[model samples]
Target chain A: MYRQDEVKEASFFDTGEGLVFSYGPQHPGTGHFRLIVRVIGDTVLSAEPDPGFVHRGEEKLCEYKTWITNIPHLERPAILDAAGMLYPYCLAVEKLMGVEPPLRARYIRPIVAELNRIGSHFYYFALYGVFLGLTTPFMWAFGDREFVVDLVQFIGGQRITHSYFVPGGVRNDVPKRVPSGLVKQFRAWYRDATGRSPSSDELTDDFQKYVLRVMEFLDARLDHYWDLMLNNALFMDRTVNVGKLTAEEAAKLGVVGVTLRATGIKRDVRIDEPYDAYGEFKFDVPVRTEGDSYARAVVAFEEMRQSIRIITQAVEGLPDGPVKNKQHPVNIRVPAGEAIARAEAAHGESVYYVRSDGTDRPYRVRMLTASFRNLIVIPYLSRGAKLAEIPAIYWSQNVWPVEWDR
Target chain B: MSESKIGYIVNELKQALGESIKEVKIDKKMTKITVEKDALVRAASVLKGLGFDHVKGVTGIDLIALKPPEDSFEVMYHAGSYSVQELANIIVTIATRIPRNNPEVPSLTSIWPSCEYHERETYEMFGIIFSGHPNLKRLLLPEWWSDAPPLRKDYRPPGR
Candidate 1:
């Protein structure tokens, strides 16, 4: 039996010139993360983000795996939004191979991608809800997010780390679940919406209509989210002015995704550098200038709404064609080239730099994920802010330490 | 064709830097600008001046084979823009090569503050020291980790 007397105890009373405190390496609020903070009373003087607790040497290991096998490995770091993390990799590999994914694959890709985006945002929202001590929001967000999970599994064949994406296009086509007449109507609506919708003559299938229903359900859920969580005065007070970041600060710090959008910087990789159905979809890049914790939360909420719109448009505009190019899924051989590809992931921009050596294996794979890029701002924000507000600011950024450590 | 955005940038760089720009390769969406290590600071500054502000990541690639008689290491600085709408569409990777034996280069933290963490990462990952960095310490690895920089091509993990 382990001896209780052998355990060392920490004393909070023993304070001297900037007492060093360990925030977490293992705490519910902080999942596998630590902040070595030098604090003077309630305010933090300096915060050093000590990450890599979950470092599995993803980059080094990527050099060994085949281009096809690497998708699952790369997707593991970011479990919440597998498509967002994997999309850039597939795009870069495709670019290297000099083959274009077919039209149907392009349209279908965004449907799953947008659903993953919504899922990632909902996961963050649930965590934010818990971090703020509101159990109701946590439960609600988690439950609602599962609808997206179920939908993706229906099409993708796996709920997490789908590995559904290949170099040329998606690994599998969407399963048929819709009638030809309704799909035609949806296709017409989609063409009207985007103006350049390619003829998916292969016929719109069952999955498109099924996802449309899911989108409608989520659209209604967003209104309820506002009422239960966003509109609450207590929740608003905790986040309104906490951990304020200016637009300039966001720009200089390489901030992307929701955090950048919250600072009134209309930077979204989907629109700025469109990939896989984004160019075909018409949607507004939501921006809020508050540049505070509350603003980031609001931006995330609005982004979910926008993602719903994107999915709805994509499903309605379901085109017919192959979901993949004429490349082998498992035995893909990319030509020698290097490409930097980025996608608008839920948290931020997920960037991948792939250097292929005309083989199944890559020479190097560098994933400068949004969470990793956003690592610099922790010290900047936490330096003078109150300790209690750290969780709100940190969670609002939607940064996953697992992804950061990767 | 006159020049793509990438080619235009490469031409401007070649003109701006007489001999310091060692080589330049323009990929699809990204441009690889290789500069002499001594001129990295100036090149980074010029890129910053051209609206490539934030350093996305600083990666150290070791090309030296086993038993280290060897070649050179390349330090790639991934830079992109946010404020500059036109420039944001392009990713310019400034790759500078240094002798593997003396893997040292001037830090770009002075030009772009965002490179601080990345510089520290490069420092710890490949043992490539960055000169003039404010606080350069172990980032991902534990403080007591006593192994060769794990990402190096020649580095062999225990029992491998």
Candidate 2:
């Protein structure tokens, strides 16, 4: 069933170089999508992605829901990163209806968004390690991530799908005891895992230092799995320069986040178009000019560090106020008009364009997700790469099908 | 750009398109501009020349139940450019209302290739035919599936 010829016909691959194969829809490496690859002997020729298996008609569903009711529904698409996904939609709706959230709500939103980002990055790291054949890192990263999830549950009343963010404010306030508890857990986790306390000041240091520590720990264990895992002689030999996408191609496709940064575009919606508390944070948008599988890995690691920096600043400088604005009922009507809102998610930028015609429900709701934009790059980058390197390239790209299909 | 500048840009576009521009109205938050079906491509060309390169999203709104003399549909093409950050949040929608029986509009795919999938999606869900679309297959729906246009105001699910 896993043979190359059978997989080839069932998938979509480039028609040149060697026989590039596809593994997906049910492949272990691909989270929840299908991959079509063109292989030139052991090398990859090109990769074309075929997604949409999990399409739930989310945008269409929004048209049937009231403005407030849609909050919980929106979290279902990307359950693991609820705050990041819903905040932009809430912001857009607020902007459209002329509702301004209080200062306290703004700070709380960022706090939750950062915590969600931490959990998401850890999830990514765990998945990345798992795909690279390093089970220990996967276990360790997931174990640490659970602590953050616990904090979310404590404040939001639910772990993954918190629907905590609303148009005018968050559903509830961060519990008084929650912040200190998280800080304690973070400290203990850092010391136990690394065998040394990350200086209290160091936790608040430049984003790079925090990232360097995490990468250093991962790097120290590198030799144990080198040829057998991530940088294995076989893995590097197959992936080093394969699936290359130059900066020009990335920009043309409007690929944002790490994929675009990997091509040296330096386009981060957070930095380029700051929203929420992002403008106040100091962090670098990591870029790599290599535009290959290895470069993508480096970009992801660097981004994890930047996220940590943003979160630290948010927690330390968090202000006080209601997390949401006082507003009319959740079923309040919106005047007839259209508005588009977007935010930088872990994968890339997710955009939502909503149209309301003086009604309780929206006239139309269109979502252009990050995964949809990033998926286009696969076909372009996969060209001229070998077959055996398919999984490595796919995993490195961090394509999440649920986000794409929804 | 100030709110006045955005107004100026809209006025400039209206004047440049002349009679091709049907209706241009600025809502509280966003601006709405409608054009004739025949002049849609030409108007898009003018907008592109004025620096609206990226098509952020293409949205279709079904107005079947409004039951106007001409059963109406509104399709919006939200365009923006990064060079003009102020204009980034300003969405210029080019809408057209076609007859419900024959909802065929000229394809913008030739002008903006990125709109191909978006238009196809509209075509599948709302049954709005883009006359010159290169590949007009169903996107989110299965090819063998049969159902009324899902996004239409009159589209009722099987049980309901």
Candidate 3:
């Protein structure tokens, strides 16, 4: 609620117990962004994330580019979840133009969207594993992600920035063999990886082996990132109860995705709104009422499971039809109007508002990304959290800074 | 609400604000209303009474080609109601044209607090001042940015 200009005295705090530290922009573990943290007595007092270091003026850039050209630009915000980011923009444009995508196209859109969701969630799980001091899980998650990326490359000719979703339908149909092939590959991979449940001893041994190997790797490359980073007893002590955003506080701030689901709000725009063939699929929206860092992590894990279920159902009901609408490309002229489209991105509910003046280009394009909305909760949540726990809290929130700054 | 009901809502909004309601267009996609520059606050007030509580987004577009002699800027306030859900999900965008020389419009932040950031963004990108806004500083632009409004048609980036 405080104005940026009114806030003064930006400095790290040491609460007479210990030295306060600042980690960001230059820190490898801090992701591709910067944040200033205030710590006192090995506990974080406040943390302010400084975004926009990578802002490329995408929104303003969209104004000049053709409607078709902006698709690639939009995907850069959250490349891992490209479909979820761009589908809403396509929907908004289609809505403004009064053009209904063919039924076949709608079904295909969701299929690709679910595939992207799986890829994105896997990537998140991989990053989360790395953040939580687990290396094997990170390698496993990322290695599995390559399978989905292969599918995307086969379908869209690009791994990360897939500009497949256009105004009326997808850019092209899903490759005939890729869907079944990927499903089989994923099943095999999962079966071979987590199939046989390990005993407690085996699990402990695996954990220790991963810790040692990861420690060696980190020790050789990045000294700052040690096995003790997130696993240290003091680290857990610092993060356990800090940044506690109850369900009420989370809802009040309109936090979404893992942040809101962590608070036990059974709301997923895909399930609730049921856009792009989601209505026919069966899935559950994960919810945890605790609204803590652990709760957020649990929610993300549960949601990943739910997303896997959705992908399974989508593959099972994969209808045989042309994925792209057959209409002539140049003949498409959206009627003069406006439309708002929302989709459940990996971060949260990402909304796109498109205003069309019956032209090939949009008159106005406004995107309310989930990270931007979730960023508001940082100031509120960081009020009492210890400094040492800042990274854990931030990672648990699952924020993508590019999406916020964009 | 039926199409007729939506029409009635638009007509009622027009009646509430006489000359302020410059243009009212109801299309298949959305219902749009353009108010006079000075009447934006009143138009927003009237729309709120009609059940548009949430300000979905405050969008601005550069219309150099469509600029009139007196006004060269256009701004829109898109608002809707989530309570009514289906029947009332219709968004009514109140657009207004302001003089490019001194583009200024009454801030709706007093009415919709969420519009605070959105308006600040518009001010940063379009250089449209939202008079009476509680905090009018730039939201996305750096404090030392010297570039013209980035979203404007004539403001070209250095290399571009």
Candidate 4:
């Protein structure tokens, strides 16, 4: 926005090589992460992801905190998908402690997890829309995500950073009554999300029926997402063939989530490991062969539907019993052993490897987040693309900086 | 017990590299194998030939003070597969130990390119040098701060 001479007088003009641009540690799209891009003309030659700007030394800090207090402390990285981020740690701790959560806890955990996944994907879409300079999807996405967040807040006391998961089970059972009217209201809002009612099915009375109703409601909204974002001419023009990756390249870089799925690998932790209630759920892992920015968006949008279907199945199959095992959150000890737990976070496989020394505190903890795994591919994908295509490719892969920095 | 996929992989590993394989242990969740430090690349190559394609994580544990004086710096490469359905779920940890005073192991990026980033992170976190990693630089830590590897047992964070 300033004069062209003011920009030219800076240190960049003296380097005498290709134009070097540093895209933010502060830009709206960068989100506390910096990108050092070396561009020639309008095309980028190399893009180095300069992370650790938001690094809190979380692994270092985990050693200082007690085992019980670290539950909430670990959730600080990926706040939007708080349950998904903390899910692995709980499973690893439970494994080390030699205890298992009850059946009721297992079923209810996935129901809430799918809700959190939907909310996280919605947040990604909102930011994706903002990055593309589209205001409608940004506006529409925020409104739609409130339904899932409200469901989360009703289960836990807070919105994000819900430290609801414990070593034995969830913090508490779902409320005795799911407040039938609220689900119906969300269903009604989702059913007519296109400003016209697409489904004419009447709502049933019980919670299982209510679950099916909400799934049908969100299923209808998927059509509009396809028509607006996925099939839009402008979005297709910008992202279709940009940032293309082969399945071989994806596997080599260890990219996960929609980034890996778009490259034609159908390896979701839900499908592979089948932990928690995922084994009982019937859902498809959406994958695409194109391996482009557009394909990644399509995969993410399709995953929302799969999540909806999974949530519906989980709630319908919700068992009745105690939510937690006998282990209390405060008074617990782990045996001297090592265990690894993997959960499908919003980004990708959130894996935690823990070692305990027959004590209450963990002796060693290693968290391999999806963001850090995918960070290696940034310099590869942005290698030959245009300068402006950087954000389109990066954000479309669902990169979360806090998770990377953690 | 011999029919499970993990058990079969463990057996195959032992059969293929019998002389170099010092120890092999199998649990319900994972398979662990220890090899000589110089034979690390050979074992990794045998693994790659067997279709265990990618490296999931690289972990370095300093047994300098945790165990007896003879204990060394132990590094484990959790290699697994993504393409082969039978081997996809198995996480085979190939372990090797080096002298604590000089920790250097051949980089696995030649066998599995996915370990490039994991090795770089391990190098910075534990100060264990991987000999042939292409761009071995500080990944998570800042450039100028050359303190002790933060994750090592003896190095405490500032103000701790």
Candidate 5:
């Protein structure tokens, strides 16, 4: 990725050493992160990851904002999976305040979370396709992800940055009726794409019927994803043995999500701790024995199927009741205590350690994102691999730059 | 069942560290173990031996913000397990206090290689030096950063 003349004019290149190539704080693959790769010929000797190009000092800002208001700001780092990002924070705050969200809210939390998970995985596949130079999957993935995002918006009112989860419960209940506009839009799209008018049952305004249809559609789409990206000859050849990580190495480095799951370790926070409705829902934590780029993609793709299963279970099992606990007010001061909560975000396990001083604002909030935990593996795995395979290994770990930077 | 597991780990920690163990807070959610500053590495070794194979997060809290200033910084290492299934759900926070004037602690990267990046981020965020860190230079912060650690209680962001 480095040009000859560009290397010649660079000051760091003047130092007597092997070729030290800085691969993007600007490149499409890196996305606001840089990797300084010191390579001898085509083999990478060591790859030093340079992160924090998008650091927003979110922890510092948390102290200033009220607990409720912080929800909007905290969800920004991993906007694609907004509900997942805020899940732990909301849990921690609720723990400190000593209030539990009602049963209905608990069910809704996971339903929306799995929707975001599906959306986020599609986004990953979209970008992963581009990184592997397959544009067809990119277009197909982003286009497919809209359906999942639409389901989330039906619940949370907004598309991407849904500040839906709060301390005691969600901001609002799932709509009793899906908006007529959304129904017409889906109807029109179905008619245009399939060249036939959709059935009234498929485009019904009933929340349960409509969301289930979307999930069924996405569940069927996973087969095409497997065919297009996961099982493709080029994808398999490029990623199969590239950046192999043993289970021992993965545990030692403390990587999570598909990266750890690919190594055959069944370590998921949702199953381990069983927060919220995760305890009620029965879903498999997908695993693959071969710890390679290909295995990671397979694990991620498999997770989408499991997410759909969880969402279906949640929707079917959702009990009718109050969504929010009215006792906890908007500006409620939390009792002085420290609590740590963990959630299985799309990237991996995101942990939030919150310390409250019996004040409206938090004394300190430490967010350990999944991407930050996996950042260690970038430098570790990139060693001894061909320079061209860097993107495959990097994106395989699912290191979202902004999520880690915050 | 999980509570007893946490109790077992807490007992092991207390027995291993003995006089060095300052406080142990055990709950269903987390088990926080505070140890002496000098005995940090020994505590980490005991934890690793107890099957806490990796560090989850390294957090620094400035206690000066409290009503009567404590004038010290608390660094906590949130450790978890993958090999030990019973201990997998637990987060054992091994914490120690360092003087605000001269905050220094031995790096635990030698014990748990996963602490490498966490320690580096802690160093830059709170200016707590990890003495034996392989690379203790700036991580998240820019190379040209010349201000007090932004996370410190006294170091307010400009225009605040």
Candidate 6:
């Protein structure tokens, strides 16, 4: 609806002699966000991040929904990693209700969550490929992501936006093997495709075995990913030393996840404060010192491998116990107290502060997502970046527009 | 391990703010320090000196609709550290309450620059003006938002 005359007359875009323009609300790199940039020649003088196209008032809406019903709405901000979004809220509400999940449920939480982490990272790489104009990796990454999503669906029921996590624990127990009907269907399909009937031991339908098979397939695929994208000469030219954020600046700006880890900061909520089953697993927090787009890409890539490691460990060491706390009712009323819960989501740290006045509905629920904290980097780094480098910097920071706007 | 960390921060806060601190609640999970409105900046500066360099969040609670009508807005700064290994697991809250009718508090952006956007969002949501905030305009709301601050208890949503 904006006209040229209105934009020209707007004082906010008037940066004296510099020309101003909106980067995107529709551009794929912007992700339903617009960055208003003022440029003199080819260098960006200033950038004002304009997010909120998808603002849904998540905090206010939480007050209207009860404890059990808010899970679906709360996970809408980061739909790609819905389990990550709900992980902290469940923990916070559990603390208020004074209930703890069983040991088996604790281990299952991370298994499903890491599957989501791997899936989310694959999606990120897919979008990053689109940003850089690479078609093969875009298709390859998305196609590879389906394996992780299928495993998620095997447990959580839906592909994405799985409202599977509840306050005291998960919704149900993890099934050990595929159903008989599906197993027969899979064997018949394999016979048709490969011209031979599948053997019993050749392709097992056990849940843990299936998950490990996917992880092994991806472990080999990541090497091919490096050959196709990360190590390519064109990617290096576009990413290296561009939009460089030093460690000092990153810490000052409070960037998190890969963006902060790329600056050599060893800060991770999973490692710092182990919530749920994170303490029971052994994994490394990948760090990169370059503080550039390439470093961020590498960090995210390495994290996917670590997620695979965590998933494998969780599945192998899962203890046998009850899944959910049957003592807690569906409409659990929280006590009159406040609690803060943080989790290392696929993106970064997500902090949820919940205040309860002895009611079924929370008095206040404040969520500070990693994307919201990372939004500050756009205005800070785009101050003097080249015009062509804007997309590289923007996608590398990985700010989810809807998450931040909420 | 976390208990000692909480104890250390609580001691530092007590030594730094002294009488200016209204209350200090030390729990196994977190440490909360409520300071007078006038001593907010000083309390934050003291915490910053203790290596709580960046803020995790800035939250505002509107207590106008309470049973006794507290008639105040409580603004809390959840601060954490990355440089100090011991303080990494701890989140120390620095909170101050201001009058609801004329809500104003000094912005902590000057102390922790990461608090800039968090403060802006809080201001836009609760109508609690941070007097010294550099950019205090709306960050999430529309440009034409003329209604009461949406997060305030009295400002009901449509069809409510």
Best candidate according to TM-score? 5
lDDT of 1 by residue, B1-160 (tens): 3136667677777777879988877757467889999888888888888888787887777766423334988899988888888876788899999998898999888888888888888898889999988888888888788988988887776655
Best by DockQ: 5
State the lDDT of candidate 5 residue by residue for A1-406, as single tens digits.
1223323223333344768878888965645989998877777767798888999999999998989889899998999989878999999988887889999999999998888888889888888888988889889998989898877887888999999999888889998788778777777655544456657866688988778767766776788789998889998988999888999988888888999999999999989989888998888999999999999999999999999999989988889999998855568788888999999999999999999888889999999999999998887777767888888999988778998789
Top candidate on lDDT is 5
State the displacement of the C-alpha of residue B122, model 3, in Å, after optimal TM-score superposition: 2.3
| C-alpha RMSD between model 6 and the true structure | 4.8
Give the i-RMS of model 1 in Å.
Answer: 6.4
Q: What DockQ was computed for model 1? A: 0.43
Interface residue Cα RMSD of candidate 3 after superposition: 3.5
Residue-wise C-alpha lDDT for candidate 1, range A1-406, written one tens digit per residue: 0112311121232245777878788864745989998766777766788998888888888877888888888988888789888988888887887888888888888888888899988888788989989878788888778778877887888886788888787888888774456456555544443444534543336575557755766786778789878899989988999878898988788887778889998988888888877898889889999899889989999988889989888878888877887766578788776888888877788888888767778878888888888877777777667778888878888898988778
True contacts kept of 6: 0.46
The TM-scores of all predictions, comma-separated, are: 0.90, 0.82, 0.77, 0.91, 0.95, 0.94
Candidate order by DockQ, highest to lowest? 5, 6, 1, 4, 2, 3
Q: Mind giving the per-residue lDDT tens digits that candidate 6 earns over A18-64?
A: 98899887855635888898887777777788887889999999888
lDDT of each: 0.80, 0.68, 0.67, 0.78, 0.87, 0.84
Tens-place lDDT per residue, model 2, A334-370, is 7766777778777777777777777788777777766
**Chain B TM-score, all predictions listed:** 0.91, 0.89, 0.90, 0.90, 0.96, 0.95
lDDT of 1 at B68: 36
Q: Looking at every candidate separately, what fraction of the true A–B Cα contacts under 8 Å does it contain? A: 0.64, 0.19, 0.17, 0.33, 0.64, 0.46
Residue A125, model 2, lDDT? 58
Residue range with the least summed lDDT across 10 consecutive positions in model 4 chain A: A1-10
Model 3 chain B lowest lDDT segment of ten: B80-89
Error of 2 at A358 (Å): 2.9
> What DockQ class does candidate 3 belong to?
acceptable
Docking class of 6: medium
Question: Is 1 or 5 the stronger prediction by DockQ?
Answer: 5
Per-residue C-alpha lDDT of model 2 across residues B1-160, encoded as one tens digit per residue: 4468568777777787788788877754466788888878887887776656556567887875542423788888876554354555555777777878788899877666556667777898899999888778765665566878888878865654
